[model samples]
Target: MAPPAPARRPYHHGDLRRAILTAALDVVAADGPGAISLRDLARRAGVSHAAPAHHFKDRAGLLTAIAAEGYSLLADALAEVPAGTPDSLRELGVQYVRFALAHPAHFEVMHRPELLHRDDLEFVAARSLAWHRLRRGVESRAAAGRGPDLEQAVLAAWSLAHGYATLRLSGNIPGEGDPAEAFRALARLTFGEPGD
Candidate 1:
């Protein structure tokens, strides 16, 4: 009879959590979130198949962490520009698109609520922070009667930016040129010149 295969060693050193997350992001970027597998991620991260469970209880847990991280990153990107100005709003949209493209893996998972633990506290807080940043730009417009209702303005801005990013990412935008430039052009068309 043949001998049994040797057992794999457990990952006990370094940041296994970060390593698994990085591997998961790579897989998501290459094949979308549905293609993610804990076994595959562990293999890619050079850990035992059970190692990912130490950090993420399951696939949903892993995705939840990714979504939270994505929102936090988006919040940081949006916060760079000063809020409560027309120019700042435009810049925020540009930043949103940039973040989407720059982190396609995280972007993909972040928007798919069904694939994540939607009630996760970290995810909720991070998402709320991103929304707060995005909403700040519209508050001034609504207060000054320069824009539509506050919620409507926020939704409109979000729709435009998210739609553009989704289209661009899916190759439906029909351009190999600069995406941010295209976004600015579209923004100009939709909202007219900044001072107009």
Candidate 2:
């Protein structure tokens, strides 16, 4: 016998890829991207050391996949905020902050520049789609005479949400009372305040 044909693995080891990625996400979430490693991930997933390599060539490949997944998730969150309406785009701003809070692993990978593959096709496509959706919302608000201008509105919303997420992640914004509720309260006050 030819060494029993290497014990042919199962067609699906209870979604091995997903398990590995999930393990990687947990690791990245707790300690950030630099903490991720294939050997550990495989061990956590109870798979062979080479298993993750089959799905992702290396650490960078894993991060790229995580980032792509993050963009897709952000797109879904933005979709929940409605299409039109004055400052409807801001709802997505709120959602973005919330998503980051809920999925720090994905968010970390999505924003980390040196870790992810900039040339990744899926990552680029999903990121473009998310950005276009945000831009369309901003332009619509501007056309409806609610937003100041397209660029300004986009910048305002992006900065506010991104800043808020960073603050939450970095513990720059302290206190209890739920980060999501605090985020919404601050957003309402920020955009709803008087004066142009």
* Whole-model lDDT per candidate: 0.89, 0.81
lDDT tens per residue, model 2, 40-114: 999898878998999889999999999999999998888887777655666777788878888888988898879
Worst 10 residues of 1 by lDDT: 137-146
**Residue ranges of candidate 2 with Cα displaced over 4 Å:** 1-12, 178-181, 188-196
TM-score of each: 0.91, 0.85
Candidate 1 residue pairs that clash: none
Q: Candidate 1: what lDDT?
A: 0.89
The model with the greatest lDDT is: 1
